[model samples]
Target: MSNDLFINLFVQITNMKQSFLAIVVMTSLVIVSCKKSATTNTNPQYKALTEAVYASGNIFPKNEYKLTANADGFLLKQIAFEGDIVSKNQMLFQLESATQDARLEAANNIFRQSEANFSDNSPILDELESQLRNARTKLANDSINYQRYKELYERNATTRIDYERAELAYQTSKNDVSARRKAWLRTKNQLYVDLQNSKSNFRVNAREDDNYRIKSFMDGKLYEVYKKQGELVRRGEAIALIGDANEVYAQLAIDESDFVKVKVGQEVLIKIDVYKDKVFKARVSKLYPKLNKADQTFRIDAEFTDEQPNAYYGMTIEANIIISQNPRVLTIPKNYLVGSDSVWIEENGDKKKIKIIKGVENLDMVEVKTGLTEKSVLVLGN
Candidate 1:
């Protein structure tokens, strides 16, 4: 076609292209501005929640006790071994007393022999007394006869031989009397010595009988066996450990910081791993004074209100110690708190920061002492 017509058509097409570009740019800018304005009107939302300190620990019995021997010693025959149920007077152990047994038997035998001898044979004292009486009677009779002979000799009615005989008879009678006296003295001395010896032997026998065997002091369920037969044990050394299975308690170890807050007689809520969702009521019975060196924790003892069957020691427990019981306090979710207990608040459609004073809290909810009212909306990131 013509040159003028071709040039006009090219110019017209270029102008039209420029106008369309301008319109597209203006439309995009309006949409962008609209989105930016919409975003500025809305504040960042946070999810607000109030929660108490929710920590976890395992369950322990309060009445459980660990038994230990005060002195070191070898084990002997255990009358009651581990897990043996025993009565109060039941035997638990027999310590090494072979020596005591031997000694006692010897002592008892000696005593029995002495008793038999004392009963069967007449006492030396009695025999000596009888002999003395007989000697006295004989001496009296001899004196009478000797006196008569001496008198006859003195009167010169008898020969010299008769006088000599009379003198000899008198002297013989005197000597016999002296010999009887000496015999009595010897017998009396022997009786005194024998009596003293008998008493001493009896004491040795009594000691031997008592020391022959070791015995139990109290009736309990035997949970530990510390000794075996024929093991040498020192005096006062423990042979085994016993526990009362009839009653058991739970024990909980708490941090040193929480130690001050926990007090005796406080009620605690206990949950066991084995007993899920089951709440057991417990009363604080004891609070230990000394801290565990390794764990830096102190223990608290609590007894179950209801009789818990099959309660064992060292089972894991989670406890919630109710320090305060402020029910129905203004509370919120704990997640909203920022730094050092700070929360984000919305004011006039702008993000505003506020400090909140929190009180007793658990895992989910916290008691809000002071902060925004209940109607205040908390924006959680959507």
Candidate 2:
């Protein structure tokens, strides 16, 4: 080959090699740019956002109460068992009552005797009444005789001594009648007072006897029975646990930091272990004012607004109380935020950090209230 032709071929090969190298560099730059975009850049968009407070608690029946014994004795009978439905004032237990029975019997006997003594046919009162009657008869006869003797003495037909004696007899009879009547009244009053006192004492004894029985305070279901028949029970010892049969509520414990955000009538979303993956809707019904120092939490009660799960006492639950929500708002990925209230945005083909006004936020997304629009492109921070 000629030297000129060989030189021309070499030049052509060198130019092609340069062109291929340029193409490879451009391809690598494009790939790197795409990767950077995917990892660090996002755009604000309109989306629904919810802000909620997480809480954990258990299911409890309404008006839950512990039934306690009011008297100390051996349990003679247990009329209600666990899981039994009971009505108000229904007897749940009966304690041994021999001592109370004996006392009540004695009181009843005394009451009856006193009642009889207060009656008009009572022997003591009847005797006093008979004495009063006899004294009245004697007074009447002596009065007539005294009046006759006085007239005779005035007309000089009877001696003054006879008239004075007759007057003395009449005065004595009147005094006797007064004494007898006083005695009758005194005895009747004493008997009446005794009857009243005895009746009052009998009633007290009867009430003490009634204490041997343990009765229900309200209509409810018995959740637990602490004592069995033949067990010894003391006054004020828990006998059973009872609560309203048809109503149940969630008792949630909110952290002290989140308690300020909680209020009555707020919507709550609940997840119970028994009903896995199913969410139940409820509303906050109550908020306890006192803080639980042991756990540094406040108690909240929530009632189901929709269908509730079949729940037992102390069933574990997880709840999210909805603090606020935005159905449509400009939002960005949470990690894309730069600092407390700022985000990184792509501006004029360069990365720019800008402050943003925030609204509601959750774990993954944040509602951007101002300083960002749907057209804004957010960049993730390193």
Candidate 3:
């Protein structure tokens, strides 16, 4: 072959090789660009994030109490019924206690009779006082005669037998006075003891009879009436239940796993079934230390900040106890997350998987603590 023809063939082969390399490089670039467009792209946003633990609870009155019957009897009258606003010590029911009333009346009559017996002019005291006055008069006269006899004996002007007789009369009068005073004091003391006994009996009988009237011990609305009129109630049986409606509290059941996260004074977002459209605010007021083994939950009592939802007892509620919060942080939409610790990103026109360090998360957003930057573009909703 000629030398020029050989050289032209070599040049043609070299150009074809260069063209093939160019086509391969363009195809690779096209494939990478298509992959980047196929995925949804978004930027990390700076926003607030909150972490919380879920809990369920019930609504109850602040101070609830049960009223029980103090005595056994037939319920003749029920003055207060369900939904009645009652005051402290208000009569709620009356039991049939005719026997108690009869006993009280007899006690009062006995008390009155004993009181009359111990009055200022009692018959026994009057008779004793009259004898005491007569004895005093006789003793005074004998004392004067004894003085006269003693003077006469000293001067030897009277017989010794007359003077001795005068002394004996004076001694007898003194003995009479002492006997009368003793008798009067004994009778008065006995009557005073009987009077006190009667008074005590009356007070005891009155107190026993007063137990028949069922009274409210607290001021609040009566929410339940367990017993009705004409119902036979025994001692200490529950007659009604009542509580104050102005203040309210929630009894929450928290999962045992979240026991350490929850604490007193933490903010709680409450939602009640009755008030579906509203969210109430409260704070944890108490924490029950023991776990309810049957349900694997612990009890938390929360109190409302301001006005509470107007609700009855046992109303169901859902609550979220906010454990932590971050006001300013870079985050990604929680739905864009592939798993707990990783997300896909569009880096240099290709889909690249990168791991992230997460801090706080909620249903809306997740906080990105590290491994990703503000300039990084994320492939969302893969």
Candidate 4:
């Protein structure tokens, strides 16, 4: 009986030891879980917040082009300075056309040389008159001789050979007059050819000279003058820069990370670095499809909808591209999200549990997609 009581006591002690071990294990598990939950709720403010992407870039107009000169010409004059407003067809710069003028003159001289070949028939008229007078004198002499010979032959006072001789003399005189007239006309015709050539040269020279006057083709502000006075410029060289003042745009580069999020026609906020406190509203007019190799970024152009005084190109403007918006989404402070895919939520007092989600987690808030509801109060930071 005594041995049986001892065995029963030993069994009771074993049961108590197991019970104590179980309690300790349970307590340790509770403590570990509580600590984890508390750690996740560090950022209490962002627990109930919505999530979205954010990006920033520069602002610029969609239509931007660097104006280069078509030819190297001396920058003779500039109508306006870099910031001066100008109209369409307004002259940006007056490249000294002296060189072109000289070229045109040279071309004209060449043409004139060709035209100087022109000679008029009238200029040979005096020679024709002299030839005509000589021909008339020969004809008269021949007629007299022919008449005398004819009279003598008719009277049988001359031989047949004499009559034939008189006839030949008259015919030779007539032929000489005809030859002289023909030669005179030939000389006049040659002069006409020379005159035609001279006129052609003039036309060619006129055409070459007119190309020197360069005109402005677009309305804008004179942004720059590349060539200066007396500066010899070559053909097809850049001389001036112009940009539209009325229709201004913001030009900026966006990072590669934010490239996919930006789209044309998205509204963006612009803050001009030069001008403080003033915020400008702009719309993305174009997004460059190709990435910039140098910066590993894409170019985005924005048109300023908000009119600002004294706007100009190359003005650095901070741009905020709106990715997405949620009117009233649930949120929690970002610091509260401490777990690998979850956050801690306070149930009553210090008691906390894990909340899980699969959505955007911004710098300030964690978007809850699942395992959590707007009904629960999340602990952000202490």
Clashes of each: 38, 0, 0, 47
TM-score of candidate 4 versus the correct structure, residues matched by position: 0.60
Ranking by lDDT: 2, 3, 4, 1
Clash pairs of candidate 2?
A: none
Best by TM-score: 2
Per-residue lDDT tens digits of candidate 2, residues 1-382?
A: 2334223222222333212111001101222233434556677767655566767789988899998988899999989898889999999899999989999999999999998887867988888888899999999999999999999999999889999999999999999999999888888889999999999999999989888998999999999998888999999999899998888899988778888888899988777778755677899999998999987888999999979876378898777777776667776666777778988788999987899998776444567889998788777765
What is the descending TM-score order?
2, 3, 1, 4
Estimate the lDDT of model 1: 0.55
lDDT of 3: 0.78
Model 1 quality (TM-score): 0.62
lDDT of each: 0.55, 0.78, 0.78, 0.57
TM-score of each: 0.62, 0.83, 0.77, 0.60
Model 1 worst lDDT window (10 residues): 20-29
User: Across residues 141-162, which tens digit of lDDT does each residue of candidate 3 receive?
Assistant: 9999999999999999999999
Cα displacement (angstroms), candidate 3, residue 311, comes to: 5.4
Error of 2 at 171 (Å): 1.2
Runs in model 2 deviating more than 4 A are 1-40, 309-311
